[model samples]
Target: MTGDVDVRRIRNSSFLTWVGLVLGSWVGLLWGSLLFMPVGAGFGIAAASAMGGYIAVPLWGTFWGLTGLSGQRNKALRDLGIKVLPDDDPLTQRVGALAARLGLTTRPWVAIMPHNNAFAIGATRNSAMVVLGQPLINTLTDAELDAIIGHELGHIATNDMRRMGLARSFQNALVWYFGFSRTLQRWVRWILTWMSEFLILAMSRRREYWADAVGAALTSKEDMISALEKLHHKPRLSSYERHHARLMIHGVDSSVFSTHPNFLQRKRALEKEKYLRFVKKPVVAEEVLAAPVTLPLVAEMAYVNSK
Candidate 1:
């Protein structure tokens, strides 16, 4: 047998984490949170802090997570110093028009990155920003570009960032603040963090597929398909951005922690969805055909609103 070991599968497995969660959640929460009781009694802290340990930290963490303007800070992008696309730029106009169509309360600031990838970031739709790659601009047609932007906007429209952030903060509070029962912080934290997988249960992979459906509906199925076909490679990203892979358009294919479906899987799923171009208007005294759309009506509404 070759001495080279393949740990690729093991790295992303959440099986052990799940086991620990099932067995340790109650013990960790009940014991850890109440430890503040004895700690307060011994240290003689203020009555509010003594009594507040259980609720305060969690609320604080969640508030910061949900309301934090993540896109405003470029540290996550490794200080790449993003320059916002010009308002008069064709691509910028397309992005703005698409944002309006999606009914996003916040007008996303579109920036061009040197990498061949794109992503959306913000705690909520109100703070969303869309970062596009320079290379991707030259690679796709106008329609394809709109479809790609539409996919990113779908993420903003659903407020995926805030949801994921809230989950992360909630779990962090439970792990760091409350997971200290009888000073056994190490064991408690391990269990809690393992259970949450760092970003709380990890954003559902379904969101990626849903975004694809929305993109297809907003533009045309052909454009969406073409865009996905062109972007088959694993995206190149800076270290910090790679750390935030869950927010990007592309990622590892078959890992449990991956935020996107495999390209083939996405394409196949899109084959069964309803795009605006595919939806036919009703006609009297004519043969009527039903469109087999597996996606929700929200996609249709989004498409219609854009028109």
Candidate 2:
């Protein structure tokens, strides 16, 4: 049974891995050629320039990956009022226990944002942080919360975070490579970037399915379904929340640009898992987890925004 589950997890991850690699390589080749061609022409060494262009792909990609872009993003989020919980805190402790149960040797840092969402962020598993929001805590029962946590952990366990980071870095490099040119090269870069995004979003949606499976394994399928239903409804946001939401990049239309699958689609996918068929329903109490220490600050910000 364990082996079969592992196989399924591996299959899902492998599919995304190949997609990212193919798209990244295609973008890198085009980006590298554009960047080096001019420099090569000026130096009267077309061959050297061509080699340099090819080499730049892997070189720039490795540099971006090692530079800790995700860590920097995490820092930016912290500056915007996200607070990291200490390991001894109740919520952090609970998440740590859950991580252990999921066979993780290192526990991810737990943080709270003032928004109404939960997400995982990090370049690697050891540095990963699982961020939750006040509204999510206020809205979900303990079992449902467990399911969400499990889903996030699944992202870490499957290395989806790192893979996505690498893919995005490739996309970023392409943007940088094309930033100054007014020629047809810029248009080409735009088209390539669009294509890359589609692949990246597809991988993201697949990862969500894998995470939902993990959530089902950790908690009951019913709990996962209930959590998805709750998440479907947008929680009332303070003006501060609204402002932040505006700054965040969201897909206005089309799943091709969205990082997550639709809620109903995710729920239905979880229902189809073979293991879930035999799993008994959970007897969850109608109690939500206590709000973290950051809740008051979030609430205060919301209150001030409303006023």
Candidate 3:
């Protein structure tokens, strides 16, 4: 019975395993080359007055592309009124210790946002930021939050955060390429532009599933599934909560174009594997473990995987 179940679970893992990594990398490379290459080449040609400057355009573009991610992250933080936590707080220590346990080379800035939320984004492994909502601390148990943190760490490990930055860069380059005008040229251009945002977001959603899988493997499948249920069962659009309009763990929108999968799908995906095994010998906080372990954060109390 154990062998049969393990084989079935392994098969499911295979199906979803590499798909997100391949898709994120491919889209990143494709969109980066298509959108930025021309701009880099143009700048290089225009700056041909200086031999070194001409040679530096492509390199410059790559540098700026990554640096530009900071601005986008800042805007998101600003809009949400997220406050950066002082580095010496107990919460920060706990979260950082978990991050270290997870083997994340970069330590993300920890912030408190107003909503029941947490998100990770940065240009490189070193630039990742993990933000948690105050409400999450009040709502979720320690382990639930850990599962959530593990999910975000998974994103950092996979460089999905960097990929998101690259996607945004592609969008910006697309806007520049089209002169930021809706002068509906041909059907082809319209189709391409119309699908650009969708493609970027779709790619993000795919990465979410990968993160979920990783989180389940790190913790127990039961932990991930239970966390989802907790999020989905929250009061309907509670205003006192941190995020209002955003359909996070439990909220809903009239439309189907959600940034994430519905709670049921996520729960099923994580719980359809071994549960008792991991829980029996769960990996906990430590500098090192003999076996691979995942570290999670408090925001995961309700939220996991941002796409």
Model 3 compared with the native: what TM-score?
0.61
Candidate-wise lDDT, in order: 0.62, 0.65, 0.55
Model 3 lDDT per residue over 205-266, tens place: 65666666655655667776776677677655556342422213333323344456677767
Query: What is the full ranking by TM-score, best candidate first?
Result: 2, 1, 3
lDDT of 1 by residue, 19-113 (tens): 33333344445544445455435333433333544455556554666456464335544566676777788777878787776555457778888
Residue ranges of candidate 3 with Cα displaced over 4 Å = 1-64, 73-79, 179-186, 235-256, 273-307
- Lowest summed lDDT across 10 adjacent residues in model 2 is found at 245-254
What is the lDDT, from 0 to 100, of the residue 30 in candidate 2? 53
Instruction: Look at candidate 2 and give me any clashing residue pairs.
Output: none
Misplaced by over 4 Å in model 1 are: 1-28, 31-53, 70-78, 182-184, 198-204, 234-240, 274-307
lDDT of 2 by residue, 34-114 (tens): 555754365345344335444555556657865764565466565767888898999999888777766676889998877
Candidate 2, which segments miss by more than 4 Å at Cα? 1-8, 11-50, 73-77, 178-182, 236-254, 274-307
Candidate 1: give the clashing pairs. none
